[model samples]
Target: MTRIKNILSVIPLFLIAVLQAQEVEFGEISKEELLEEKYELDPDAEAAVLYRSQNTYLQSSGGGARLITEVHERIKLYSKNGFGHATETIHLYKGKSARETVGKIKAFTYNLVNDKVVKSELDKDQIFENEYSYSYDQVKFTMPNVKEGSVIEFMYRINSPFIWNIDEFRFQRDIPIKRLEAELRTPEGFNFKQTHKGFIFFTPSTEKKMDNRLGMDVVVTRFDLKDIPALKAESYVDNIDNYRSGALFELVSVDIPGTVYKSYSQSWGDVAKTIGSSSDYKNELDKTRSFKNELDPLLQGKTNQLEILKLLFKYVKEQITWNGVDGKSFQNGIKTTLKEKKGNVADINLLLVAMLRYAGIKANPVILSTKDNAIPLFPTLDRLNYVIAHATINGKDYYMDATEEFSDVNLLPIRDYNWGGLLVDNPNKVWKHIGRIAPKKADNMHLLKVVVGADGTIEGSYQSRLTHHSAYQFRERYKEKEEDEFLNDLERKLSNIEISGYEVKNAAGYEGNVTESFTYEMENGADIINDKIYFYPLAFLRKEENPFKLEKREYPIDYGFPFQDRYMVEITLPEGYVVESLPKNIVMNLPDNLGKYKYVIRHMGNKIQLSTIFDINSEIISAVNYLDLKEYYNQVIIKGLEQVVLAKAANGRDTGSTGNK
Candidate 1:
């Protein structure tokens, strides 16, 4: 009996070893993984990350240190929708003298064939490289033979000469992750500040060890998580990545036993000082003789500071065209940019600032991260990606971006209306809120005149006026399209309608509101049953769906700017028809006056008039109030769907001549 017990104990240990070996590993494909059709945690997920591991450390080579990171990931596709996950792109940063490099890339796709695992290796020729910009390049590859019920895995290593450039390690993505493992090993000399964001909280285990290869002591931080849900995205979010659970490391200082200690970006002042002294930034602004001759003539007779500022802004906008590149530092010098007549954001906006300063207007450069880049969480130089011009006239601040043709003084592009920005003014750097202090209004009014026919068809004349951001968006979207194309698109949006006599005013000028008027005929716009006619008050302009559909939201809703939309509609009843009933007038207001909606309808002799005013005064609504906002929108949608009922006159005796009070 004792001998049997010993054998049973050994068998349990053997089984444990076998189970441990089944865990995912690099260069290994398992039959069980390939057979998994759906993830238990998120059954609706199109794909899932089965396992991921990332290890980053510093290695000493050739009397210098290089940052090395190794990554391995395994993913399973549940349907064709997940095929997009089969392709991977790695971004590499390039500098003037040294650039980051990737090597040792291997990928495979495994699928079950006749109850057996079959794997296809990626071909080396299938990998391709593209130059993303002057400072970045990307390498992309697709796994071979990827399909539903297939498991794909890839591993690669990146070697970076720039030791301070450490990218964030994200724990959450658009797809669910079953298992994750990450480690960061830093030597004793380098000091880094770690920052974490997102709704998920992760605690890292840290340890210290001696490294024989580097001949130094190092600290290791490790993170392990399982069954992490995907970061679900909702509407009106500025940047979903900003709310993703991740850890970022920023190099703060470097210290060596026998060498001088150095500090970097210890505060906002340090960041401003470092960038303000760079040749590509402040140096470019200092040399203004190249465009002085042209600017002098434009501002010679202009004595008003605001006028001079406007003139300089217009001159730079008309002179240089944006090349659609975003950078805080100029790629080419201002002289070359001026001569070429086209440059990146920094090249164009910085020149505008220089010209404004030369014109004796107090202007400076405002460095910020665009909406797509996410808000900067720390005071680091790399956190900022774009720059614009800021000027103060008559004690009022005006932010300008010359890249946008429809943008004017104090009206910046929507992308630049992020959290805030840093004003780089030498030693007097200050943080300024861009979109919060003064809301950008989107005032719009719609007037409609309609006639109901006996055949249930409707003819209407519609006119819309848009101002501020609304006008800017209208001009930006339809400016390049032909009138006929625009009309066709409108018709497609408002189904069952044929538009004619479409006219637009103030589309070519940036100073006034955009006006659009069109005549349209719609079939089946009203329902006529026996002697009664029924139709919606707002017609095609009614709100059919509420935008806030999520049960809960963890991120704030960013509207970019406050807006108001108003509609005034009138419908002349068909001949011999009298109004029987009208939808009740309703008014709803969000808490704290963040938003409001009003709808009123009136019945007159042979006519029905309806008006609605919808407005949101807050640029951003916090997630804490998401339920309130969602309910408010639901009520608005419900009210907009209410219909009006019209009854045929009794005895066909034109009782419609008497107004209903």
Candidate 2:
């Protein structure tokens, strides 16, 4: 009986082994994986990560230590959406006093053909490097013979001279990561601090192994993460990288017995003090005598802090042009930039700080990470990317970054609106938020009127009013693009319409409402069948698409700023016609009065007027409110598509009956 029972269990065990064969393995492309058409776990994914590995540690060289991180990845492309681009790129950072570089790389592409594996190795000549600036460079290589059902793999190592530059290991990406492993080993003289972001939880396997590197006793730490899902991006969010699943290891302190002891990753106050003490920043603050002469003429005997501040701010903005880099330390002194009139972000903004101090407005330099850059999650002077001036007017702090030519005083360029900034004060240091004051509002208003003829052809007029952030965007677009190009875009968008002409108000100013008016004619925007005509009441003023498509969202839905969009349209009926069907008007409201939507349709003697008011009074909505926001917009889109139907009277002629639609 016992032998029989053992034999029964053997059959089940055999089936388990066969099922596990579908799992991933590095450098081993099974026929099942190559033949597979889709990943059952995520049907929408075009490509998937089979495996990823990272091993970062300190390698001793010539009596000094350099940080080395080795990396390997295996990816499978399932469709053309994933196969079009298969280039591998690595970013290398270099500093004045420290250096970092990438080592030789090995990569290959594999495809299954006629039940056999075919291999294509990446050529040595295909590798190229691009140096972005004096501080950074990138190396790139494209995989060879990549196609759908291809398995591509690459491995490389990077060496860095700065210990604090230890990078974070991201477990999640645009595609799912099946298995990710990372290991770190350092000498006893080094210590580190770790941070974890995103929703996934990973329990690391820890073990101590004896090793000797850099002429010192070292212990290795290993971490292995498994089955991390993809962190997909969604609309209405700022820098999804801020909330991705990852682990960061930063060097906290270095203690070399009887030789040197240095500390990093300190308290916020210490971080500010270190920045204030740097000669690059401290010296720029002290040199007020140099720019005082230039400010005297611009100041014009102004006594109010706000007046002096505006004069100096306007002077720097008009006189200098940014070289399109974000930094806190100047490459050249402010005095030189004032004369040369062309400088990087630091050179342009630091001069503003110097001038403000000369005028005795009690201004200081504050560093901010733009929306494109990673949010500064910790108090470290090294990671801050951009600098702006901070002033106290009537005991209120106003932060300004003049890197953008279209910037208007406290109404900063949109990118500078990241959450927090580090304020560098001599003895008293603090973290300043991007908005200590109330947040700004967004306004976009449109008025459209059209008249439909007997045969369903239409003539129309459109006028738009923009304010605040909306005004800034309009001013920027008209300044950048040609007038003909802008009007051509409108003609193409309005669907079966010809733009007769248009005019713009405040084409070159920052401080007022921008107005735009245009005239047009529509060919088939309204449909006519026999003696009946049909049209959506709003015409071109309707919302085109639903911005929120994801069934589920992981982050807060941020509109960036509070906004209100108002659209109104009036449609005049053709001769001898009356409304037969009209969509029921609807009203929707978000909880807590965060948002409201209203649609109204009124039938006048000869015209039908429709108006929709959609407004959100706050900049951000919590995840708990996402479902509501998604449903609200979906209803708006549905209502915007509702049609207005008209029927001809007994005396009317069927002119459109013979015309082809």
Candidate 3:
């Protein structure tokens, strides 16, 4: 972000030294890399990628040519933490009819012995493959004799049946890459579109060559980068993948002589039309006309559209359990989902839309990619990874996803609240865009009535309300654990303080707010010296440390959604006690009206009243405001940890307790 280091010029010098330093073949050990003490690029890196290359081409197999990629990488470990480099895990996408397969993997870890280099070859028996999900598997292997100062190298080839979907490449990782290269060679028939992302920019060299075997001229694209800094993960980004330097290649079209000029890439409108017309999708909703026998009984002739929407949402969410897999299309259709009471995201959400249509409410399915998945860079069907339902209620489009049990109407999982959703109709087979809904006053509010005892123990009645994302988070955990277990966890977070009178409101419903009230008795939570007492008013709710540790940030700060938090405390004092010291009321804000923070402290009657508000009005902050945001949270943290002091009347001398509780 500051200046591009002239790594291109510097790398050639190393390239010259590397040429004669030692052998740098696939199996040959490079003594210079193994004995390397510190990586000049990043001295703190536990490991470094010495050299890595991915060469992809179309190869003939099974009477046709398929996409095949050969990958080779060499790594040098600086410490034990780098041992993970020796273990390789390749994710293979295997469906019912198509798959990506790995071929001929050779791995070796080299180390210096008493007089010569020792090689520990990888055993084929050590390689194991297992299904990670319904449509994905991982082939895992760990090299032998991996340790500190070891140079590990491995090479493998992968052949994918889906030729149009080329593998994306990353130029950066968590560790520095001393030298990185990726080359792609394809026949002239294919026209591919390449897109790049991240703060770093790169250009690839291209050349053409004739292939006699294929009888076509092939284009070779080579990307070479040096001293590529590691992409460290920071707080507040939607996904680190969004900021990592990478490239994506998608086939746009293929025009072979004597063959048809087929288009491999389609517009989003076409993708929506194609999906809406699919038998597995549009037809799924059309078949629900037969569900009237079951739907009529539940609706009971209720004509209220809002009530019907709630009933349908509750029925689908409560009756059918999510299979925990999200997808764009239904696997078993809506009928099977209703009968079996279990299905994937598409099945459950589609069923909701069908029942809604049967009830005379106009509804459709909206497909979008989740936050954790790749950012949808282009208009392609492959970019869509999830589906939810949208309905017009009183001239307003309300989005809903029943995959989550507690998800209410118009409330979706945080992951589903990404960029935007594509609204597609089944009956009409048309598509439109649905904008994202913003959250308002979704604060984690805390109100506490506390009194410090003479024996240094603090007692309080704690009440808190969690709204929006905070509510969903707490309700999710509450559902996962039993009552006592949940209480224990809450106490553990509050420093093992005893909590009673605990009551949870709206735990079973999705609307309004989640209310949690409890009485707490905390020992050693206050300090007493002679006639003075000092304690933190927040109890265990204080933020112990700042979340932003980086001096500078290069990516946007994403809070997923805008949020607010307020803590109001009313600490009652003893009969003769008076306020000895109180934190000064302070306000901190971001420039240009981005965000603001306020800490107001005052004494009301016989109690010290404190009100603190931290609001992030914007959903996201660009990298330019990162340092300001970081400092804002730091001030909030400091104020959250500030202490409140009280002194007994009698000889009202200025004596105070020192040291933190």
Candidate 4:
């Protein structure tokens, strides 16, 4: 009986192998897949990757060697939400002289109709190309005749003249993947260093074989993985791509006979030296004559270094507007940028550095990856995408980005709040870290005065003050909005209350705080049941839902900044009513002072005063503390739901018992 059981298990395994081999081939759709309504492992999944494979190798000729990557992917759509998977986008890199090209594209969508498979071929004319940036382009296409329960497959080849530029091979995505296979082949003349990231790790099977076509030995690395769960997105994550599972190949060295040896991978110091010596970077900074005429006049009578720094900073900000492009090197030279009065991030910030140096202030360029871009896993020049200016004033470093008009010294745009940046001082030839030691802060204060009538109508005057990041965000949102439109939206958000006398102060200024005041009237704001009234003290300001809902999280919670929110409210009870119940005063704090919450209430004659403060001190909470954080939010929600009760008094005297609810 035991032998029979073992043989039965082997038979199932062998059958599964046969089925996988037969069903996963390109351009072939099995009946079982087309008829399947949902994925077995994740029934609610919108789509699933049926199969994915990639082959990367080098092609050498008398002229030179080029890299070629062949990719094939098959996906199944289970519902309308999965229809987005039918559209695919491929990003290509453009070089100064040559660019990567995609060709030999083929795709088809298969649908089950009347128990038969119908295939629709993709039209080549439907494919379109778009310029994404100065260095990148996108090739996009949608599958023809796609619908629910349809399987789509596509195959393409990318040819690159730059052999060292090997893009990362991703094995995980936002949707579940059943099987993934990848192979990389390289000749003996080149060496590569590979790095893997994310929670899932794959050990590639490596081997060596002689290539008869090239008459050389090649190293082949193969990776095969099955059943990879999707990387679920969660709230408060800085960048989802930072936690993706993938492998990146960086060319380490090239050693060929009768040719000089070249090394591509180097330490941070070496990378800094290479950047400093580059003609496009250091040479551009040295060309101070381009802006000498304007900058010299701006700093003519400015003797103090600090004053000169501020003058130059303001001059660049007001002079050149950002063209909404992010780059590390100049797209238009400094001379043209000044002439056009607009340029990319590098153009504006580098010009600031140049002018500061011309004014005899210690300044340098700080290279960093924006929050949208993934954090740099290794020290490669390609990892840095954005640049800002760093200055030393009174023995303290101040980071500044002229692209943001409302930003102040040391208060960079939130996009620049990634891990850390590298300070590139060309003359000194030194590279050091610009740490993110201070957390960005925002403060909000809300004051409400409420009057409850015998008819159960609630009227109140609402005023709020915002500072720091909060003020910046408010200005960015409402700066372009019409007053009537802004009030309409606010009314909808504040529980459809009727609002009037709305006024906002300091909305157009970069200094001080933003203040907003409005009077409101809300119906059904409280429950009335014959001589008794019940209402929440916070009114529309209460937090109804908890943002942290995941049972378990793999990524850290990135709030981007630490913040404090406070509310002070005074409610005037209806005439001839006495307080029957009040919410208990409570205080809650997270471990190690990471966060705090406090609530207090006082019954002062006919007026009830309430105040609450909620503050989070740390910007990032690790995954290990996720449960604690989730529970903390749950408690806050519970407290906000507590109600205040009032009862009719007798003879204008206290008649109802007052106690904590």
Candidate 5:
């Protein structure tokens, strides 16, 4: 009896060991619990799981969805015999019971290009397994040769009963799979190279962890070696249909007939359950509210509009920080953003809208996802990503995105003002167009009084003004630098001049227009030689040298917005000197009537006056007018480099008269 009991125990232990060995030998699913859980899901829901789904909607149009299916792909390779060639075929079937539609397959091609497969005369038959046979009558192909790397890129749509863009196709024991095999074709010693830019396989054998472009976790199935050449991989469609196909086929009994994508989407509710509002979020919203309330009265006051704008911008940028995700716009709902303080694009913009509304101002929240970040909204409310506020002041609409740092209250960052925007207003569902590109305006002028001694020495005091967009740029770029450092740097750039005293007028702060005036001293670089003192205008400070540095741009060039710039300089000539030549006044008008420039030079008695004005009427000049605009700017920059020549009186013309004397 003792020996029999021991034998029984040994038998059970041996069975357990065998089972354990099988589980580890190959990546297998052995959980009966998992199987039961899967079976319990709705069959129609299972079918929907296999479909590809996309959302494209907007608040105006409600929202929309798209389902994709049966993607067929064939790749052909032409190669020298030694180089080897291959083709891969993928026929994905999606929809309710998509797997049930996969019919009988006698033969399938693997690692063999169309030419090779045809040459081998492999049977393109259907393999019947569970409730379906895999069929591949359709032939779509990508033929990439060494010569056409940049010119050819191919994509195909396939109906997959499984998940869309799944990392791997898994199969388990259940349905009879006749030939479970895999074939790989690559350069003699080539290995797979992992890349984030393109698709790759993640298999049970993969050991490397990686993060995808979307910041999602993933793994690498294979690594590439330098010596490797082209690569091709194929696996006989897994026929162990019981788990893979059976799971897919079972969907036929259910009413929902979609793809695995639909199934996953349906599970979004479950995901939402895992995320609940936290107390931290509540606290952040309260702080944002308190901050807004504190600033309300100040903003409402009849302060200088520009000063108010600047202050408002500073306050908003400082008050709230972005959580660094897109889609925070109003479409996601502002209440959620107000509650979270750190919402996506829509959320933050909504908060801006709420603040403006609370301040008793007419503000509309404009909705749009940045170009690269979200898909273009289809017919419905979809793909909206970010938001900005549209405020109306004195019958003028101003677009503002406080989320962008350094942007003034009414100014929209170039990134936020793309092509079109939907302004959210209850009575009006109109799509408002963002104006043309902003114009860049910058101008600086210096006037100096100089005394030239008999020995050709000189000294002078100078006054100057740097105005318009140029002023704003200089300030922003140097905001971090000390005031003395900034002025010192300017003095250094005008090094030929000796500085006596300097004052930055209208530089206390930036108010819509940046205007600065300063005083300085300088020595003349030229002296009278036989009364013909030759002098050249300093071109280093020339306003037109290189205003537009970009050689070419895919998008429009923008200054801060509509802009105007003016610079005037006056220089008191020496006592015995008379102006010889002066730069001619030049004007450039944009081809499409976009803008104009005025260059003026005036000579009055012993004084030289130089004034320049650049004005851009509007932003969105049509692309059709690019050629004319380009030509116009070319002329302006060229003429801006022209010099003003000066000549002095003859040696005896003014006897014993020092320029200062």
Candidate 6:
């Protein structure tokens, strides 16, 4: 009898395996194949299916045979008649042994009040293993309660396609979702094309998917087959929403279920305790008992505190590496990270704070969410995502992000230096503001002494000095490549100005301001029309390379850091030719002194000096300032490319002039 029972179990197991394989129709596919397919499902299609039905495990992963937890979504889509759909789902996770005892569950219902999600009520259930005969448990969910409206609205569970350094789960339906436009964010040199409805296929699509920028998997669809005539399509960055909600409208998942589950789900505290409970954690703790003296070398027997502090800041940033993302398991704090040589943002920065404290230096951990995260700090623990160390030396405080490799002791990378950062004073303590980004000032001085021939050919050696932010950005561009490649790339990016010969100086060391002097020979492509040669004056740096490409946006445009840009170009005209028209000298003060722009042109004999300066006084500005900023940029661009006409000298007598000359 036992042998017969074993054979029966084997048959069901084999059949179950077969079903699992068949259900996986939407596995990872090549870009070519993905593009070929007309309709594709989301990566979480498996989860989506579970949410499609009522009495199904909608939000629990612990029950394989029996769904234990679920979220019920109900909506009343009413124009005149009540045509509303209600959906309930139960999510279940089955353990390694399809045992009912191992199952866990939870449930919730979205509540909408006057077209807004007022609250979510979690469901309570009794332990029921009788839901499924095969070692099963269950999660129960009911439909969300909502009022009648011209439009249906609610929030739905969504998993992020991009697994940044940290995982992001979205439940946005604050507004209606229309023509959804989501651009795949990626680093430079990489390009991608859309595949299927919501998926974008990345270039060089590799079989070995390890997740770089090889494109992220996404799922988007309009569930209501009957489209509303008034509803139009729209797009939003970093979020999904409904576009048209006539009067009283709130986005509520009517037919969709929840997207969370339990299957041996590990909690942060649990993971930390388990690890910290072991000898490994103890051994690691012992290793980093105290931070070594990082400032001794800088002192060099002088005992200068300022220099020592600087050295200490530099050492911590260089020696400690930020893992960028917080580990799901690392709750024991910085001690665990110190011994491992690698830790999450919180771990590393907190460790740095500990180190400073150990070294008798005053340092505090500043908690902040990176620009991408954009969580508001309202005294809630949820707002704090990452940490950076702030230290005061000689009565001046400097922000230090130890995780970043390119950041100096006082300077934060533009990427992390967003709007505002909150400095958390340890656990359960008052918060302090670490402030926003620093004012990056770039003073560019270009002195070109060219011996122009009578043929209108400008031959000169140009020395360009870039200071502050400009130099920092310049160093970052060719940081990965060799010297020759860097120079070639730099020249190419500058402009269409043809350089017959060139040289680069002060390009390597990134401590501060960089000065590059290059020998250049180029004809200022000026067309002489009726003795008036119009020089476009696109300049080495033109406005066509404008970076702000934002559209009508809902969120605020954050520059993060303030910056000042100064451009000075001195060009020596040919001995025979004379300057007929130089760009007008213009100076304008920005609104509220947030920034300033100045353009000055001075002609000293045959040489003309053109200077342009734009300075941004503040980093954190309101969105209302965007229009002014945009307008300022527009003017700067027009002025930068403004032409300077040079008339050729009548060659002893009057004759037909050549456009080339």
The local distance difference test score of model 1 is: 0.81
Model 6 C-alpha lDDT per residue in residues 432-488, reported as the tens digit of each score: 454554655555666655454455455556677777656777677747788677667
In candidate 1, position 44 carries an lDDT of 92
Tens-place lDDT per residue, model 1, 1-661, is 0001121121111100001122466767778888788999889999999999888776655645677888899999999999999999998988677888999999999989999888899999999999887668999999999889999999999998775567898999899999998888876666778899888878998877765644556778888988988987888888999988989988776675776766654566666666777776556787878766777777777899987888888888888899888888887668888889999999999999888878777888888888888787887777678889988888898889999889888778888888677777753555433433344788899999989987789998999999888888899888889888888888988765899898989888676799999999999899988878888878888877788887878889988888999999988888877877788888889888899998878876777778889999988889998999999988887887778788777785654333323
lDDT of 5 by residue, 1-661 (tens): 0001121121111100001111111112123211221222222111101111111110111121112222221211122321121232344432223321222221222232332311122233322123111211334222333121011112233322232122222222111111222111111111233222112222323432322222222222322111111111112111112112110101111112231211122121221121112222122222345545566677766555435544555655666666655543232344454445555554565566555555556666565545443223121122334567667777766666666544555455545544455554532333443433243334455454544443445455555555554555555755767977777777677654555455555444554544444444445555556656544343334444343333332223433345555555555566776666666777778765578888776766666666666677664454355556566667766666565445556776632212210
**Residue 493's lDDT in candidate 1:** 85
TM-score of each: 0.92, 0.88, 0.90, 0.92, 0.47, 0.56
Clashes of each: 0, 0, 1, 0, 56, 38
lDDT of 4: 0.82
- lDDT of candidate 3 over 268-300, digit per residue (tens): 677677777777675667887568788888888
Tens-digit per-residue lDDT, 1-661, candidate 4: 0001121121111100001132357877899989888888888899999999888876643445567888899999999999999999998888677788899999999998899899999999999999887778899999999998999999999887666667888888989999998888876666789999888978999887766655556778888999888887888999988888889887777676766776666776666666667775678898888666777677778799877877787888889999988888898978999999999999999998988888888899988888897687777777778889999978987788899887666767888888787788988768766666364678899999999877788999999999877888888878778888888998988888999999999988766789999999988888999879988888888887888887888888988888999999999889888888888999888877888889888788788888989888888888888888888888888998999888888785854333333
Better of 2 and 3 by TM-score: 3
lDDT of candidate 2 vs native? Answer: 0.74
- Measured on C-alpha atoms, candidate 3 has an lDDT of 0.78
By summed lDDT, which 10 consecutive residues of candidate 2 come out lowest? 11-20
lDDT of each: 0.81, 0.74, 0.78, 0.82, 0.39, 0.44
- Find the candidate with the highest lDDT and give its number: 4
> What TM-score number comes out for model 4?
0.92
Per-residue lDDT value at 337 in model 2: 88
| Candidate 5 local distance difference test against the native | 0.39
Cα deviation of 94, candidate 5, in Å: 24
- Candidate 2 residue lDDT tens string, 1-661: 0001121221111100001122334467677768777777887788888788887775545644566787888887889898743777787877766557887688889999888988898888989988865457889898999888898888888987774466777778877777777777655555667778777887665444444222345545566666677777888887788778887766676665764566654776666666777896766677777765777776767899987887778888889988886777887778788788978888888888888888888788877777777766776655667778878889977666676766667777777777667687653455343432234787889999889888878888999998877788878888888988887876777775788768999868676688999898887778988779998888876777888888778777767678898888888888788777778878899998999999988777677778789999887788778889988989998998899888876665442311101
